[model samples]
Target: MQENTGAGYPGDAGVTDDFALAGVPDAFQRLWTPHRMAYIKGGQHQFKNENDCPFCVGPGRTDEEALIVYRGRTCYVVLNLFPYNPGHLLVCPYRHIPDYTDLTLEETAEFADLTQTGMRVLRKVSNAAGFNLGMNQGVVGGAGISAHLHQHIVPRWGGDGNFFPIIAQTKAITQTLDEVRQQVADAWPGETDAE
Candidate 1:
């Protein structure tokens, strides 16, 4: 066994680095990949109106199931199909407007509620050390689904990093979305569905 570096890492001496980690997640940095970012670009289909939005789809659509976690008359939360972290999620108003001004006062309050709920649930399930919360409002601002503005709430960890994004350019996820979904779903029931 190798001695720990006392810097929070085990010594590398005699350590046979397992390449299989590339598949199973040995480092958080390798998780970010071109395929992932390309999808994050969120510019596949351009719609002249908000009607073309997938987030706007009804729950009964029977297509790609809307990852709606919490739903109210005006606002709700959804799991990000493409995520920056395990519990990455989106909070938005049901109204199909890109401009933030379109959301009513009640809807904004619900949005705040959803954000708090999402953070609480993420903390319970992932044991996450931190979070990255923001909104990408347009193509110029990194909005993939710019037609309808949504807030992204990303869960984070302290050591969930490596040289990949700075070097090889990847971000490795140590947990599976399935596992993440299950844990987050179970953490606080209503984060996925409103109480």
Candidate 2:
């Protein structure tokens, strides 16, 4: 009797009599970040009062430490520490308001202005194909930091999304936060009409 050889598999090259298993070869590469476990596990600290909020305390921190890209009078732009994409940023009012309606006219204007500027700067610096820009208002709305109001500016590339994010729930941020912050800061527009 003839024995079966795994010739159907792409890279099997006819499995030997030793019964070794082979996998199909592909061009895809993987980037695993187990460190994100800490961010995921520390869920208790995410939805707290203003005093304990990162956005409330963020302005007081040094630009590099806080990953701040630009500081407007009423609003500021900061890099997202846990980014969905490489140059992901967040535009927020200094006030730790939980809702959009809580913003004053000045705060609202600057928030909109800074968000626009962040998109422009990200485009200039990273040459992003597009962006995902919006705010998650509450816990039910998918806000990780529900006590603070902030708009996310996620830069998107043509083929950035892949199996990893879908299958493993991992996003591969290509650049470090500090590196992206500096690049965006340098390319930021100066004295815009919104200012």
Best-matching candidate per lDDT? 2
Give the deviation of candidate 1 from the true structure as CA RMSD.
12.1
Misplaced by over 4 Å in model 2 are 1-47, 192-195
What tens digits encode model 2's per-residue C-alpha lDDT throughout 46-151? 5577777889888999999999988999999999888888988999899888889999999999999888788877787889889999997876676778778999
TM-score per model over all chains:
0.67, 0.74
Predictions in order: lDDT:
0.71, 0.81
Superposition error at 193 for model 2 (Å): 9.4
RMSD list, candidates in order: 12.1, 9.0
Candidate 2 positional error at 154, Å: 0.8
